[model samples]
Target: MPRVSTDQLAARRQQILDGARACFARYGYEGATVRRLEQTTGLSRGAIFHHYRDKDALFLALAEQDAGRMADVVAEQGLVQVMRDLLAHPPATDPASADESSWLGTRLEISRRLRTEPEFRQRWSSHSAELTRATRERLERQRRAGTLRDDVPVAVLAQYLELVLEGLVSHLAMGLPADDLEPVLDLVEAGVRRR
Candidate 1:
């Protein structure tokens, strides 16, 4: 009977979004159901609908939240530092063990969901642009430092790098082995490295 305050509503909305993220990551957009979401959030259908008109809207919100989080993380690390961190924490293996199958499976599922969901695709594109710009800026800084090749166009190289990364992610999702990534990374490094 009583009306909820705006802050309470926002908190409840975030809880729903967090639940949606886990559901989508586990089952994907197509497989995730309203009932499952309700179960995950412990929210009634009416309450869920009150916050989001439908599943698609809820998914879009989730995608946007993910995009923002990714941007913040990347922004904090910078490109070179991020690469170093990634290499140090290679997605294919744990610190205590060499098994990367679990990590790869989770990435594959997220990639599949991104490709199939329109909302995800749109959010990915926008987020990718931001990332590309950040990378280009970093490359320019490297160029000034005489660490990057001066001959190639940075924008063109950035675009190519983005495409290559996307392809690699897709391939990894398709069960490509960790050993197979070396050649691809080598080629990409050769192209981008200073002569």
Candidate 2:
């Protein structure tokens, strides 16, 4: 067997993640069977499993990737912008055409899994904590800058923002009207901003 370069290995791993993302998005966790994953990824089960131990591990990788991205958004733009991004890009019927569909699908699936699968929830707590930490750090920066309200503790503000994000996600997942949420998000942002 020939040795693969580091870049090649990284690229192959990324390919699996990308294909698995679309597969999982199109069909929820339970629906994305090994065969479907193979077909979508254009790689045999052996190849896919080489990168991930099993289906659950593969899904966790995808979810973790999303969490990292969300944490980046929180660190840079605040958590509200994450919700705004969801509103900005409505879920597309075509998964290939719209990134938001994959994102929303993953989020919806994560929410479902968290509620029904205690093991998954346990595995996910650390990743979830990363997002919370990012939110708190951002809030702390704002406080230092004299922008965030001083009365509320940073931890409380982070929780509040996280809850608001969950509600927004639920609203969108339920197919509720999201067309008129800018003002609502604005109010959320304002609530934490310094008076």
Candidate 3:
């Protein structure tokens, strides 16, 4: 067979990811089977296996994408604005796509998996650390600008925000509406901001 170009390979990979995203959105993480992914992607089971070792790995890839997107937004807008934007307008997993299926429900399953799955936990920790580092940098800037209060340690505050964000994911998994988190976040911001 002739060699496939880099662009073709990337497009095919993305198509698979999109298909997986839609399948997961329509069916919960536990509910979305490899057979379901095959149907969604229009690829045979063997083909899907060629790309991912198994279901868990595929799910992790999707979760990694979500984490990266969030980290990018946080790094770009700063944690405060990201929280405010999240409060102002609810967003689906992939905002650009018109699909209503969301990854919010999937996080709960991952959170449960994290307890027993050491590899999964390690992957999650790395992603969480990246966000934490970005948030910590932003916090340092805020501290120097006199926006963050002096009472709380910057490291503690950054970790607190990270934990709060993780809790929000868990809540979303539990069917908590994103909007309901607004007041909770408001309280957190108030607690952290200088009076």
Output the number of the TM-score-best candidate.
Answer: 2
Taking the tens digit of each residue's C-alpha lDDT, what string does model 3 give over 1-195? 999899987777777777887777667567788888898888888877777888888888877776666667777766655565544534345423314234443445567778778888987888767778878887788889998899989999987887876766555445457766667777988888899
- Candidate 1: tens digits of C-alpha lDDT, residues 95-172: 223232222223344467676777767656765566777778767777888878889888887777666756665654
Alpha-carbon runs more than 4 Å astray in model 3: 80-103, 177-180
What are the TM-scores, per candidate, against the unseen true structure?
0.64, 0.91, 0.77
Task: Give the residue spans of candidate 1 off by over 4 A.
Answer: 1-7, 78-128, 145-147, 178-195
Candidate 1 is scored at a TM of 0.64
Better of 1 and 2 by TM-score: 2
Error of 2 at 58 (Å): 0.1
| Model 2 misplaced stretches (Cα beyond 4 Å) | 93-101
